[model samples]
Target: MRILNLLKIAFKAIVLNKMRTLLTMLGIIIGVASVIAMLAIGEGSKASIRETISAMGSNMVTVRPGADDRGPARGSGGDVQTLIYKDYEKIKEEVSLINYITPVVNGGGQVINGSNNWPSTIYGVNPDYLNIKVVGLQSGSMFTDAEVQSASKVVLLGQTVVDNVFPDEEPVGKMIRFNNIPFKVIGVLEEKGENTFGQDQDDVVIAPYTTVQKRILAIDYLNQIMASAVSEDDASEVVEQVTEILRSQHKLLDSEDDDFTVRSMEELISTFSSTSEMLTILLVAVASISLLIGGIGIMNIMYVSVKERTKEIGLRMAVGGKGSDILMQFLIEAILISITGGLLGVLLGLTATVFIENFLHWPTSVALYSIIVSFAVCAITGIFFGWYPAKKAAALDPITALRYE
Candidate 1:
């Protein structure tokens, strides 16, 4: 039989029962649409998180105090401070992987300017801190390396601090008091928005490590250290080198554990990337269940169609159409229904993704692979679900169908 003739017969049958055909296709439409939308949302969230993490400087590494392994054999308090300026010095001198190193101590207080004060956080670090973090100065200048080493009580304000404290005045060389000790402001940092951890980078102040250590904290030890590797590929090696240096400098043998943790940007990015990708796959997997249900619905309707048209099938078979022809006609009809529904679902899913992305202000990206996968799934479901009905119709006894009431 001619495919067009068979397709015409199929079309006539569907047109005869338009409402049934529409209802049968509803499941496929919903399933395809959900899968596309869910995948788009997942990809968008993953991209957003990655951007947030990158904004903190992709080549950076952070060193923080970890559980002390060598101190007093577990319960003893001999751990003391794990991080100190001497460790920073050794890492800079001995580790070739480290490009820049800086010690940091943080405290929060209300910043006052002519009776207009804003509560903010502060970081005390060396002049190399800006270079290591790739932080740019928006106006004025950063505290010179000379000033940092001299403990010259100089400070740099962030953009947010500038907006609040000296909105109408030039803050260069102006005095801002921290812990009631006045320090001259030498520069302002460029604006950096919120990080993945939800920290406002532009809401804090930066002061020389010497001044912050001796004056504010009044301690010789550092709370944390920030360093940057030459490149992302070298980050792990840099971490290993820094760990060994700190361990050796602190006089911990191989028998004793280290008291510090070193984390690389590549490690963090990979962790977040894997987590995001898995979540996306999981969401898509869950949405695929809807597709399965829809496919089953299609199969159910196809079965009903074959039973209700049994006599018609026998008439066609007796007239000259072979059983194979009958099967092909029915299978093609199912494919047409599914393809139509699948295309519509793709359009609807794209529209919904656009609305969601624009309304919620999240990143949404639709990969071409998703569309191809969706359509392929639709076709597979149609063929798999249509098989039973096609086979049943092909097996119909012409005499029995002809005598049907």
Candidate 2:
């Protein structure tokens, strides 16, 4: 028989038992759909995390004081007072790979403008901090070097703070008291939604580090130092140079442990990306099991199909139909069912992804590779599962099959 005739007969056989054909295709449909949905979710989460971290800053690094000993009592790491203003100055002056550096003094207090009051974190920093952290102004301008030097009571407001304190009026040039000290509002930062760790980025105030140290916190040591490298490729080199400078400034001997810690945004990104990749792989693996089960289901159905159509097979063979023709017909039937189910699965999966994104507000990205892989798996499943039953049907004796009830 010609290939076209075999295909026609195969399709006719499937159409004659529409309900059974539909049930058989269900396994493939569910399998392919599950695979696509799982991969979409995984890929979307990875992309979202990367975007969140990137929004925080570019090629940034943070330096914080390490552990210290107070009269034989050891202090916890990052609680030591070893990071000082001089370390910030030296990093700025000596490190050529560094583009920006600033000393950070952190404090929190109630911000009040007339009857409006909102609690916010106060980040004391220099002018360079705005550039290093990649924060932009929604209005007004950053405090100048002269303002920082004089410990001027000027501040920048994050979007969250602006909304809460200055909801009814413009915030720039307005006076907002922090811890009862009146500070003039210099700027309002652009909105930054949230970081990867789920902390609101735009829920605080920025001020000159000197003011927070001398007037508010009343401390000489810095809580942390923020810096940015000249380029992403130069981040590691900049970190090494900064570490050497801090060790020398603190007068640490070769055998002494350093009294500070340095962390790079690049390193953080890599760590988080690796974790997300692992999770994606795990999800893909779990989803693939369904495909295997679907294949097994196809195999079982094809076997039953061969048994029920024995008399039809015998009649075709008696009418000069070859065994190869019978094999081709059954195989083609299986492929048609799988291919149709696969196409439907693709549509269903895409719809599900959009629904998940809209209703759950969870991100989902459907990649071309995922579709190709799902379709290819469907094709392979059809062939592998259909081959055995097709071979068995072709090997049947026409005499025995014709005598079968």
Candidate 3:
């Protein structure tokens, strides 16, 4: 009966001061909403990066020329010429876990079709390149092993090249020049669009590495070796086997460090995930400041509320109201304000996230934990901030309080 009366009194007090209560809760509302929005953006970005890397072939591994030791004796990794065609052949013959392998060489040049030309990257790879990359042809077929052996000047155009260089005409079965070196178009690749790094995946041309090495770059060494494991689970095993084979093929002693760098898609994914997580943590930390400010707002408002109700407290005390009852009454008022504000904040946060994702095209993924945690924090804030003011009201001398103007 006593608790119900205290609750009624608390409810009555809040109803009498609607505007003041709302203004007091504004801090908590903004704080909770900000925290939720920040968390959604963070989680969404992490997922987006993982998905982009996975689409590039989760079972793939890349071997690049370079010593990772960063020693003064070793030049930059991309500039190293340690990876050769023989190293690729040795791995192909020795490693059983990989399902597809290709020796890759790349150069940047303008691809010309009549008067139309676009600056694009040309990737020299064998027939297995498409298989390793997990991409398929939209028209025509990939170059055959015979073409690779003959160093035939045949090319496959990505969607961007087709759009720019052959907008009104079919790209397949046509002649195009790369750096003034004429080539026959064998195929057109499907549209892959931009990746997570914002690089255009479609702005490329692929041909046999032999053609690029002998005729274009005049280089005898391979730029890189790309392979795909039979299964994503086998990627690590494939990496290990390729490393051992390359080391043996190079005739390096056991004590010598590797002259090449090998990395699997799984490793790449893990690295990206870790970095994204750190960024998420940072964003969430910055958003948490709003919650602290909201708590402080609650405390200040409760203090003012106690001061304004001093006469009411004194009259109640004279009318046989217990100090504990007065304390509970004010504390209940604070809690009601906090909880109501929390509910509004949640709705605002969800709406803001949707707006950001749909209108602004920003990534957002609201975690259930974030909402629950924010609400829990709100309740705790109410109790913590409301305590001292309630205590002060309870300790006031009834006679003295009644005499105050």
Candidate 4:
């Protein structure tokens, strides 16, 4: 009965100072909302990156030509012609950790179907390229190893390519001209969406590496080499082995630097995870400041509340209320205010997240942990900030408080 009466009085007091209560809660509202929003955005981005990387094969490593220090001081020299098919074949034969190896030479130009033309990147790779890239055919069949060896003018269309050139017709067995050269479309790749780097997965056309090297670009070297390890755990080992092999093939002495850079999916994932965790921490830290401000606001209003209600407290004390009761009442009022603000902030945060996701077309994933953390933070803020004022109110001398105006 006593607790209920005290809670009733606290509720009435808050009701009487509606404007002040709302203003005090404003900081908490913004803090909780921003924390939730930032966390959701960060989680979504991390998930998207992981998905894209996983799609490219979990145990894969890419080797791109780095500037040869022997030829270039920084970025001026070191010609683009570095890696060759021989290096790819050597890596395949020499590295036991390697499960698949493929060389890629890419060219970009207009792909034409009669009067219709679309700009797309054309990749030339072998049958092993599909395995290394983890690409799957949605329609028709991938070019066989024989076609790749024969340098056949056969191509595979990505989904976006299909939409652009053969919207209404089946692309398989259809011919598309690239740079006036006719190449038959043998297959279409399933849509893998965009990569984390914002490159469209569907806007690519793939052909035999030999064809792109000899017939189209007349290039004798590769743009990049992709290799998949026998197992994900062995990816680092495989990268080291491939790097050694490339270094040897390029005739780089031990004293010389590597002319290529080897990157593994594992390393990239770790870097992304570390970077994301840092960003999440930074965002939460900034949001916590708002919570602190809100706490201070609560403390200020609570002090004012205790002052304004001094006469009431004196009357209650004189009528038989103890110091602990006065302390409990004020503490309860502070907790109620915080909890109310927390509930409202949670709703506002979730609603704002939904709005941003829909309006901006960016993915957002709200985690249950975020809600739990926010509530805990709010509760703790209440106790910590409300302690001083509640203690002050409890220690008041009833006789002196009665004399207070």
Candidate 5:
């Protein structure tokens, strides 16, 4: 038989039982849609994380005081105040790979601007902090080096802080009090949304580390040190250089643990990327179960179809239709069902992704590779599950089939 004739017969047979055909295709549709949606969510999360990390500066490295071990009871890193302002100065002068360095001291207090008051975090950093973090000002200018040296009570407001404290007024040159200590707002940072950890990136204030350490927190020790390598490729080298310098400065012998910890942005990115990829794989694996179930549904329905059309199969054989032709017809019907379902599944998956992103405010990305993979799976499922049933139909004996009621 001609291929066109076989296709016509196959399509006609499927059309005769539209409801059954649709029911059989349901599994494939659901399976494909689930796979696409799950993968899209995973991909989107990975991209978002990468973007957030990059926005914070991919070449950045942070140094924090290490935890103090007290005979099986260990204190948190923040509990130890081993890092000092002198450490920051040494790293800045000694590390050639480091392009920017700043000591960080943080405190939380209620910020008051006239009748409007909001609770906010206050970050104490040097003039280099903004450039190191790749943050830009929306208006006004950063505090000068001279201002930092003088321990001036000048500050930069994050977008969220500006929204809460100075909702109706221009923030620049305006005074906001933290813990009732007035500081002039020199600049406002551009909005940076949220980080991967869901922390508000623009919900704080920036000031000179000296001012924050000496005036607000009233301590000489630094909370943390933030630095950026000249290039991404130099980040690891910078971390090594920072570690060596800190270890030497703290007078740690070869047998003793260092009093500080240094972490590179690349390490953070790699860790998060691995986690996201694993999650994506797990989700895809779970979604694949639906496709497998759908394939099984195809097999079961095709078996029933073979039994119902046994007499028809015998008649076709008696009328010069080859067994191969019979097999091809049934196989084509199965393929048509799956391929149609797959196309519909693609549309459904895309709709679901858009809904998730818009309504849930979650990120979702549909890659072309995912679409192609889903379609390929559909085609393979049709062939693999339809084969045995097609073989059974082709094997029917005309003599016996004619005798049946």
Candidate 6:
């Protein structure tokens, strides 16, 4: 009646039906592996989004036209061209928390240089735009303030533009036309492949806001304004200051909502992280169905096991074997099966994560907590599902059991 002897007896019985035991473990193995892989992908995607946002400046803040609370009464989205040059000037003069700020405007058109052409966007910005974006140049220099003030047709090209427009030659000092307006290329931005949103960060041309506003779009209102706070910790304060300043500039009363939206990179990061976490939970839930099914399988097989071994149970009881020992033996067998499957599942999950990241080029970050959680769940499942059958076997009457055909 020793626990060790019970374990040996249970294990021997399981080994006698090796194929059935293996089949019963299949659902658990698949479930654990699925949970691990899904969580890894979710965590990795969250991390990637944060990294991408940080690269664009963790302390970056954006001021776009329109209130998010939109209606016929309030300002609309996207096309609400309320941001003006005067507002940009006031912020540059009033705000002390910002390290750099720039007014942004853009127009998309075909970029042509000699016999080659490619579709690209031309961004209208001042010299500080690069600083605000935390980007640097690969060659030459940014357009001077004089160029911006004079609406000089000077431009800076991103790597993607350079590759397509000036493939055979150095992009600096070359002449390119954007929407039929000729621009002197003064610099080439360092390569930035793509952002998390799948937008090509490099297929751009940077020019003075004056040039873009007057020459390409012929618009007076600013499209967007971007700024970098003194540090990441100061981003929220900067956002608050910018919001109040814009509200005052727009001359909106307390009851009247201002026509602008302010956002910080920190807020963006948190929003994305939350979204990824929700998606992870959903995927984990779906994968957990397999575990549920596996638990049911254990219960089903245990019931069959108890029925087949009834005669054995009666014989053991006749030899003075206690029902407690019988219950313990069956319970221990179920747990061993679950834990063994869980270990194999952990190994398979790690392998799957590696394959996904390396071969499929998907992101994957395996948290140690995931493995521990899966293992604990497996053990708990065995106990929960194995209890009823074990209890039934323990409650059987040896007298009637022995008299059975």
CA lDDT of each prediction against the hidden true structure: 0.84, 0.89, 0.90, 0.85, 0.91, 0.88
TM-score of 2: 0.76
**TM-scores for candidates 1 onward, in order:** 0.74, 0.76, 0.69, 0.71, 0.72, 0.70
Tell me the alpha-carbon RMSD of every candidate. 4.8, 4.6, 5.5, 5.3, 5.1, 5.5
Cα-lDDT of candidate 3: 0.90
Model 4 regions lying over 4 Å from their true place: 1-20, 38-60, 65-100, 105-122, 131-138, 144-154, 159-169, 174-184, 190-204, 208-223, 228-241, 248-252, 264-287, 318-321, 360-363
Per-residue CA lDDT of model 5 for 1-405, tens digit only, reads 499999999999999999999998899999999999999999999988888888989989999897444457767665688998889999999999988999999999989999999999999998889888899999989998888899999999999989998999999989999999999999999899888778899998999988998899998898899999999889999999999999999999999987887988999888998999999999999989999899899999999999988888888988988989999999999999889889988888999999999999888899999999998999999999999999998888887765556
Off by over 4 Å in 3: 1-9, 40-60, 68-101, 105-137, 140-155, 163-167, 173-186, 192-203, 208-222, 228-245, 248-251, 263-286, 310-327, 351-367, 392-405
Candidate 6: tens digits of C-alpha lDDT, residues 1-405: 488899999899889989989988887788788888888898888778877888888889989898877766754444788899888888878889998999999888999999999999889999999998889999999998899999999999999999998988998988999999999999999887888778889989999999999999999999899999999889999989888889899999999977898999988778888999899999889878887788788889988988988988888889987999888878987887788778888888899999999999988899999899987888888898988999888888999767656
- Sorting all predicted structures by lDDT, with the top scorer first, yields 5, 3, 2, 6, 4, 1
As for model 5, its CA RMSD to the true structure in angstroms is 5.1
lDDT value, residue 11 of candidate 6: 93
Q: Highest TM-score: which candidate?
A: 2
Q: What is the lDDT, from 0 to 100, of the residue 334 in candidate 5?
A: 90
- Whole-model alpha-carbon lDDT for candidate 2: 0.89
Instruction: Give the alpha carbon lDDT tens digit for every residue of 45-81 in model 4.
Output: 7777677678978788888787445454555212456
Alpha carbon lDDT at 41, candidate 3 = 89
> What are the per-residue Cα lDDT tens digits for candidate 1 across 1-405?
498898998888888889988988888888898889888988888878777766787778888776545456553221346788888888888888778888888777877777767888778888778877778997788887888878888889988888999989888889887767788888999888777677888998899888887887777888888998888788899889988888888888898777787888888888998998998999899879988998898889889999889889989988998898899888887887888779888998899899998898768888778889998999999999988899989988899987876
On TM-score, who's better, 4 or 5?
5
Model 4 global lDDT (CA atoms, 0 to 1)? 0.85
